[model samples]
Target: MRSLLSKVAVGLVFVFGGGLWAASAVADDVAHKVVIQVSTDDERTQKIALNNAVNIQKSLGVDEVKIEIVAYGPGLGLMTTAGKQSQRVADLVLQDITFSACNNTIKKITKKKGAAPKLVEGVGIVDSGAVRIIELQQQGYAYIRP
Candidate 1:
């Protein structure tokens, strides 16, 4: 009977202790977060920012990272439908990456061009890209400018 009880205790420990270990492992695997800023009009700079985001997502498993790219000023063009990177942006959006366009920049462009720029599908609009970057940083997201 004592031997039976010892075996039972060992089984319980393996079950319960293993559960706790798994839970702590999941907790330690907290998703990595980052907010990338792109305020340059240079196409090369914009592509570099996109590449940085992709590389980070790849280094960490896609499901283990959250990434947001904020574009304002001259960089706002990168999020527009007519932008050279529009197709790539769309592809990245499908992979769970976020793209933000500044409404303030859109308004300025509208006033200058008589119409607001058309954003690529899945692009989110923020009141200001700078403010969005600050908000993300306050929320513990690492900031990147690439």
Candidate 2:
């Protein structure tokens, strides 16, 4: 009788634990994630990157997808308040897309220009753009450069 009770308890634990694990896996599978890298200041490249993000969101549905754009070096210009694409950036931000600027780039630009460039409202600053991209990739986000 004791042996039978022990076996039953073990089975119950496995059943419950397996259910929890399966639920977690399904949750992760339902959301698609992508990280886009922008290292150039070229307007065309920035536009292409933004377009890619928009297309992904439209195809996957905003609630089912996560998109992040990482800007470093000269590409940080795209995230600046005074950037040529500031209006577009702001519009995208309203749609739940994330824009990240590199702190290292901001510091360098500040040192050279005597002031830090202001990022568009709602933009986040990461310690390093490349590092952030790598971390996101490690977390299962697809990487893109356009």
Candidate 3:
């Protein structure tokens, strides 16, 4: 009886302790880099993407999150200083989230509008938004177009 009780106790401890370790292991998986592709000018989807990015940072903790909002084509407007989402997006920019404006789109807009498109302060300009998405994917950053 004594030996049987000791074995059961050991089994129970192993199972319970293993569960604890699994939970903490999940916590350790918080660090991840993700790139959000924005090519459409759809207002609804644009807002959803930004909200999701912010939610991701909040839920995972900002330090553990590397989010990039890549704007190209018509989506470039979302990153423009003239964007209607200016206030909310600017606030997120202050939170250190990555915002990249596509150089190609800027040039196109400049030609059409006869002026350079303005980007939010602190946003980086990249060669092509599509190219950047491929680049990030090559570097193992998950692509999410939320």
TM-score of each: 0.80, 0.87, 0.77
Whose lDDT is higher: candidate 2's or candidate 3's?
A: 2
**Most TM-score-accurate candidate:** 2
Runs of candidate 1 exceeding 4 Å displacement:
1-30
Location of the lowest summed lDDT over 10 successive residues in candidate 3: 24-33
Best by lDDT: 2
lDDT of 2 by residue, 90-125 (tens): 999999999999999999999999999999999999
Compose the digit string of candidate 3's lDDT tens values, residues 37-69: 888889999999899898889888888878899
Question: Could you tell me which residue pairs clash in candidate 3?
Answer: none
Q: Which RMSD values do the candidates have, in order?
A: 6.1, 2.7, 7.9
Off by over 4 Å in 2: 1-30
lDDT (C-alpha) at residue 22 in model 1? 97
Backbone clashes in model 1, listed as residue pairs: none
lDDT of each: 0.94, 0.96, 0.88
lDDT for position 126 in model 2: 99
Q: Please give the lDDT score at residue 117 for candidate 1.
A: 98
> Candidate 2 at 25: error in angstroms?
5.6
Candidate 2 to truth, TM: 0.87
What's the ranking of the predictions by TM-score, best on top? 2, 1, 3
